[model samples]
Target: MALMITDECINCDVCEPECPNGAISQGDETYVIDPALCTECVGHYETSQCVEVCPVDCIVKDPSHDESEDDLRAKFERIAGN
Candidate 1:
């Protein structure tokens, strides 16, 4: 599943650069992750970098975009063009 940023986000900006997929962006109040671009770092890293860098632990999975690992890998490959 794709990850999302919760209201608990302090807008610390730490998680933005950590996201290898470039899915995280500045939202109205907090950083938000684009579900379409989010692959949980499956093809890039062992874990979600945004969640890993978020100090407040605000990054969580988006149940709405629930997808299997194969789907995530496809998304990653599509974004990476490989």
Candidate 2:
């Protein structure tokens, strides 16, 4: 599943660079994660980098974009053309 930034996000900008997929970006107020490009760091790391770096713990699973491990891997490969 892709990770999401909740309203609790302080817009610290700490988690933006941590995302390997480059899915996290600044929104109007708080930062946001792009579900289409997000892979939850599946092929890049053991866990979601955004979640690992978020100070406010605002990063959480995006229920609307729920995906399985296999699906995440496929998405990764598709984007990366691997």
Instruction: Name the best candidate (by lDDT).
Output: 1
Per-residue lDDT of 1-82 in model 1, one digit per residue for the tens?
9998889999888988888888989988888999999999999899888888888998999999999999999999999999
Please give the clash total of every predicted structure, in order: 0, 0
- Native-vs-model 2 lDDT? 0.90
Root mean square deviation (Cα) for candidate 1: 0.7
Worst 10 residues of 1 by lDDT: 46-55
CA lDDT scores, all candidates in order? 0.91, 0.90
- Estimated TM-score per prediction? 0.96, 0.96
Worst 10-residue lDDT window, candidate 2? 47-56
- Candidate 1: C-alpha lDDT: 0.91
